[model samples]
Target: MRSPFVQLLTARRFAPLFVTQFLGAFNDNLLKASLGIFVTYRLAEQSGLGASSLVMLAGGLFITPFFLFSGASGTLADRTDKATIARWVKLAEIGIMGLGAWGLWQQSIPLLLAALFGLGTHSTVFGPIKYALLPQHLGADELVAGNALIEAGTFLAILLGTILGGSVVLFDRGALVVGGVGVGCAIAGWITSRQIPPAPASVGPDAPRPRLLRDSLDVVQYVTSQSKLLLPALAVSWFWLFGATVVSGLPVLAKDVLFANEQVVTLMLALFAIGVGVGSILAERLLHGEVSARHVPLGGCVMAFCAVDLYLGSLGRPRATELAGAATFLREPGSWRILADLVGLAAGGGLFTVPLYAILQHESEPSHRARVIAANNIINALAMTVAAVVAAALLARGMTMGELLGLCGVATIPVIVITAWIVRRGLMKGVVRLVLRVLYRVEVDGLEHVRAALPHAVIAAN
Candidate 1:
C-alpha cells in the first residue's frame, strides 16, 4: 500500500502546490539568512549599528508586513481563486528576490530591508491562500495528510534554507552565489506555481471587500466573535509564541549556557525543526487521516513536561572551559538529555499544531475561511512579538535563559488549560449535545469531530 504522502507527492493536485510552497519558504529563509550574515559581518562596520541589532531590525522588517497586510491578503484570497493568487504571489517573489539580490550585491541595507518587507508581504498573501485552498483540493480523508506534508515540508525547507544560506554567505563570492540561489529559487517557485490546478472562489460576488485597516480589525473580530474560530486561532497563536521564544533563545543558550559554538546552535535548531517535521508526519499516522484535536491536550502535556525538563537540565550544566563545538557538545554530560528535551518539545508542538490548523480550515465558513485564517495570522504575529518582548524583559530582569525557559514552560500550562477550556467551554461543556447539534450533519458524520471536541468518552445512565 502506498502512503498518502507518496500518493499526494505524485498527484498533480498536490505535487506542484507542494513544490511551490517548499520553494517559496526556502527562498525566503535563504534571503533572510544571507542578509543576516551580510549585515552581521560586512555592514555592521560601515552602517554604525551593532551586528545583533541589525539582525533584529531585519527580523522586525520581515515581520511587519504580516501585521499590516494579512487581512487584505486574506480578503483577497477569499474573494478570488486561491491558486491564481498563489501564482501572482510567486511572480512577485521573483521581483522581490531580484531586488534582494541587488541589495546583497551592492551591500545596500535600505534595498535589502525593503526586500525583506516585500518578502514578508509575499508570505502574508500566500498564507491564507494555502490554508484555505487545501480543503478545496484534498478530500475529507486526505486533509490531514495534505496538511501534514505541507507542515513537514515547510519546516524542513526552513531548516535547509537557514543552513545553506548561512554557509553559502561565507564564501569569497558569497554575495553573488547567494544572489543567484535566491533568484533561481524564486523562478523555480514561480514555475511550480504555474502547474497548480485552479482553486476558484466558492463565495459569490457579495463577499466582503478588502480594506486594509478595517479588514484587519474585522477579521480579528470575526475570529473572536465565534468560539470555534477563536479557540483554534488562539491555540495557533500560542504555538507561534512558544516557537518564536524557543528558536530565538537557542543561540544564547548555545553560546553562553552550554558554552557551545555556532555549529551547536545550528545542530540544536536542526533537532527542533526536524523533530517538528517528524511529529507532523507522526500526527498523520497516529490520527489515521482523521482531523481532530483529541490529541492536542496530550501533545500540550508532553510539551510542558519536556520544556520543564529542559529547564531543569540546563540549570546544573557545568559550563565548559572554552566554547564547545558540535562534537564536544554532544559528548558533554547532560547534553543528550537537553537535546532530547528539545526534540520532545518540538515534536509535541508539531502534534499540537497540525490539528488546530485543520480546525481553522475545517470549521470555517468557506466564504470567509481565508479571512478567518488571516485573522489568525495577525494574532500569531502579535503573539510572536509579545514573546520576543517578554523574553527580553525577563532576561533583562536578571533571569537566566534557563529560568526564562522555565518560565515559558510554566506559562504553557495556562495556554493548554485555556485551549481546553475554550474547546469545552466554547460548546458550553456539553460535548455530546454540541457535537450533535453543530457538527453532526455538517462535519462529524465521520465522528472525528465528536472525538476531537471531547476530552474522553462520556458515559451516563439515569
Candidate 2:
C-alpha cells in the first residue's frame, strides 16, 4: 500500500481543501491573537481594567458567539452546498476584518469588542461548515490524514499568530500594523477558499431548517443516536475544553508562578504548539491510513498521566531571575523538567484530539455532519466559558497558577478514567476481534501468495 502522506498528496481533492482549511485557521488565529494582545496592552490603558481582566473579557467576547450561533450555522451548512457556504464564510471574514481594522484605527475598546464579537460570529458560522465539508470532499480512508494535516496547520498557525501578536505590540504603531496584517491574512484565506472544489449539499432539498432551539435539539438528538459518533464527539469537545483551560491559564502560570516575562510565556506556548503539531502529524504516519479508533483510549490514558506530571512540574516555584532567555531557561534544572512536562502534555493532547476528530468525521452521517460539528463547537465554547470562570475564581481565591495546575491535574484523572471506561465498554471487544481476524487473514494471504508464485502452485480460497 502507498504511504499515508503519499496517498494524501495523490488525492486530487485534498490539497486545495487542506490549503483552504489551513489558511482559514491561520487567519482566524492571526486576528484573534492580534486582538488579544491589543486588549491586553493598549485597551487596558484606555479602559482602566487590568490586563488580565481585559484579556478574559476579550476571550469571552470571542467565544460567546459560538454558544449563541453554532446551531444556526450548523443548520446552514447542512442546508447549503458546502463550497458556497465556504465562500460566503470567507467573505464574512473579510467584512469582520474590516471592522477590526476600523477598531484598530480608532483605538476604541468598545469598537474592538464589537469587532471581536463579529469575528466570533464569523467563526461560529464557519465551524459546522468546515467539519462537515471534509466528509464530502475526502474519502473515509483519508479522514485521519486530513484531520492530522488540519491539526498541524492549526497549531502552527497558533504559534505564528501568537509570536506575531506579541511582537507587534512592541512596535510604535502596533495596532495599525497588526490590523493590516490581519486583513491581509483574511483576504488570503478568502483566495484559498475560492480554490476549494465544489462540494454538493449533503442535506435534501426538503430538509427542514428549524428554529435555533429546535435545530439544536434535533442536531443533538441526531448525533446521540449514533453511539460511535456521540462518544468521539464528546471526547473531541472535552479535548478542546481541556485545551482552553491550559492555553487561557498559561499567561498566569508563566507570570505568577514561574515569575517569567512575556517572552518566556510566548516561548512556552510555542514549544507546546510545536509539540502538538509534531504529534498530530506523527499520528497520521503511525496509523498508515487505517482507522485507528483503538488509539483513542490509549491517548486518553497518556493525557491523564501527562496532566498530572504537568502539575508535578509546577510544584516548586522558580527563582525570579531564572526566567530569562530560552537558553538560560533550558539550562536550569527545574526548567528541563517543566519543558518535559509541557511536551508530554502537548503530545498527549495531540494523540487524544486527532483521533477523536477522525472518529467523529468517520462515524457521523454526512447529511447531519455539519450540525454535529456545530454541537461540538457549542460544547467547546461552554467548556471554555467554564474554564475561564473556574480559573478566575481559583486565582481570585489566592490560589497560585501552580496550585491551579495541580487541581486541573487531579481533576483530569477522574475525567480520563470515566472516559476510558465508557470507550472500553463500547469499543474493546470489537477492536480485539478485528485485530485477531486481521492477523489470521494476513497469515492466510501470505501463504497463498507464496504458493501462487511457485510453478504449478495451487491456491486455497480458505
Candidate 3:
C-alpha cells in the first residue's frame, strides 16, 4: 500500500466510500460471472442457445439498466442525499442477491436474469453517487489519487469477483456458495455506506420528478454545454468502447486466434487489470495528485501503438489441436509480445481515465455533477454495447479478430485528436505538453508546470 492510499483508506471520509464502492463492484461482477457460468454450463442444452449468445445476453442484461434508467437515477441522486442513496442501493442489493440465490438454487433462468437486471439497476443508481461524492468528500489535491484508487480497486474487484465466480460455480454446492457471498458483500456494503459522512443534496428539493428520456437528454446537454466538460465525457465514453471491445473479444481472441485454453483467458484478464492498477497509481504519482489530463494524449498514443502491436503479434500464430494452456502459452517467447501489448493497452486506460475522471469531478458544478456523471455512464454503456455489436458483426462478416482490433487502434487517433482539440482547443499542444512534462521534472514554485496548466505552455510549439 502506498503511504497516501494507506492514509485515505484509514481515514473516515474516504475509506467507507472506498470500501462501499469496492464491495458493490465485487458483488456485481460476482453475480454476472456466476450467472454466465450457470447459464452456459447448466442450461446450454435446454436453453438451446450457444455459449456466446447466452453469455452475451447475460452481459447485456447487466448493462441495460444504465442505458434505460440513468435519467431517473441521476435525478434521484441529485435531489436526495447521495449517502442516503448509497445506503438504499446497498440495501436493495441484499434483496436482489436473495432473489438471485433462489434462482441459482432452483436453476430458474428467468429468475436469475431478472435478478441480474435488478443488479444492473442497482449499479445504475449507485454509479452517479459514487463519482459525484468524490469532490464533496476529498480535497482537490487528493482528487487524482482518489479517482485512481477507485479505478484500480474497481478493475481488481472485477478481476477477483470474476475469478471467484467462475471457479466456485463449478462446485455441486456452487449456488449456495455464490449466493451467500453475494448477500454477504451486499450486507457489508450497506454497513459501510452507513459510515459515509453525510453529503446533502446539492440540488433543491423542488426539482421535477424525473422524466426518463427528457431528464437524460437534459443531463447530457448539461455535460456537453461546457466545451471543456465534453472532452472528459467523450474521452471516457471512447475508453469504454475500446475497453469493451478488447475485453469482450479477448475470449474469442484467446480461444480462436491464440488457440489458448480457458486459463489463458484468466491470465490475460489479470495482466490487463494489474496493468491498469499499476498505471493508475503511477498516474497519481506523476501528477502529484493534481487533477489534470496532461498524460492523456500520451496514454492514447500508447494504446494506439500497442493495439497495432497486438494485431501484428497475433498474425501467423500456429493453431493448436488442443488449446494451449496458460503454462504452454507463457513458455513461448512470442506470447510475451502479446502479453506486453495487452498490458500497454490496459495501462493506457488507467493513465487516461484516472485523470479525466478527476478532471470531471473537479470541474463540474456541485449541484449537477451527479447528472453529468450519469450522462457519462449512459454514454459509456451505449458505447460499450456498440463495441459488442460491431465486433460480432465484423467477425461474422469474416473479419479477422486482429483486423478488428487493429481497427480499434486506427480509430483511436481521430478520437484523440478530436477530444484533445475540443478539450484543449489544440492537438499538437497536448502532445508537446506531455512530452515536456515527461522530459523535465523542473519545479516552478516547487510544483511541476504540467498540472494547473494542463495544456500549458503548449511549449509554444503549436
Off-target runs (Cα >4 Å) in candidate 3 are 48-51, 422-442, 447-462
Global fold similarity of model 2 (TM-score): 0.88
TM-score of every candidate relative to the true structure: 0.91, 0.88, 0.92
Q: Pick the candidate with the highest TM-score.
A: 3
Write down the lDDT of every candidate, Cα atoms only: 0.86, 0.74, 0.86
Predictions: Cα RMSD each: 5.5, 4.9, 3.7
What TM-score number comes out for model 1? 0.91
Q: Clashes in candidate 1: how many?
A: 0
- By lDDT, is 2 or 3 better? 3
Model 3 poorest 10 in a row by lDDT = 442-451
Candidate 3 residue pairs in backbone clash: none
> What number of backbone clashes does candidate 3 have, counting pairs of residues 3 or more apart or in separate chains?
0
lDDT for model 1, on a 0 to 1 scale? 0.86
- As for TM-score, the candidate ahead, 1 or 2, is 1
Which is superior by TM-score, 2 or 3? 3
- lDDT string for model 2 (1-462, tens) is 666656665665676666666666666666677767777767787788898777778778888877677787888888888778788888888887788778877878787778788878877887787677777777766777878877877787777877786677547888778778878877887887777778887878898774676776667777778787777777777777777777767888877776676777788888789778777876676565555555666666666677677767767765675556666656656877777777777777787788778777777777777888988777677776777788878789898777776666666676677666776754676566578778765322354356446786766665
- Write candidate 1's Cα lDDT for 1-462 as tens digits: 999999999998999999999998998899889888889888988999899898989999999988888889889998899988998999999999999989988999999999998999999999998888889989867888888888889888888888888888878888888889889999999998989899988788798778887898889998999988898888878888998888889988887777889999899989999889887888888778876777677678778889899989987777667899899888988999999999999998998898889888999998888999899999999999999988898888887777777777788898788767655643353456557678765332446666666787674544
Query: Candidate 3, residues 218-300: lDDT per residue as tens digits?
Result: 88888878866887888988888998788767888998889998899999999999988888888898777767786787778
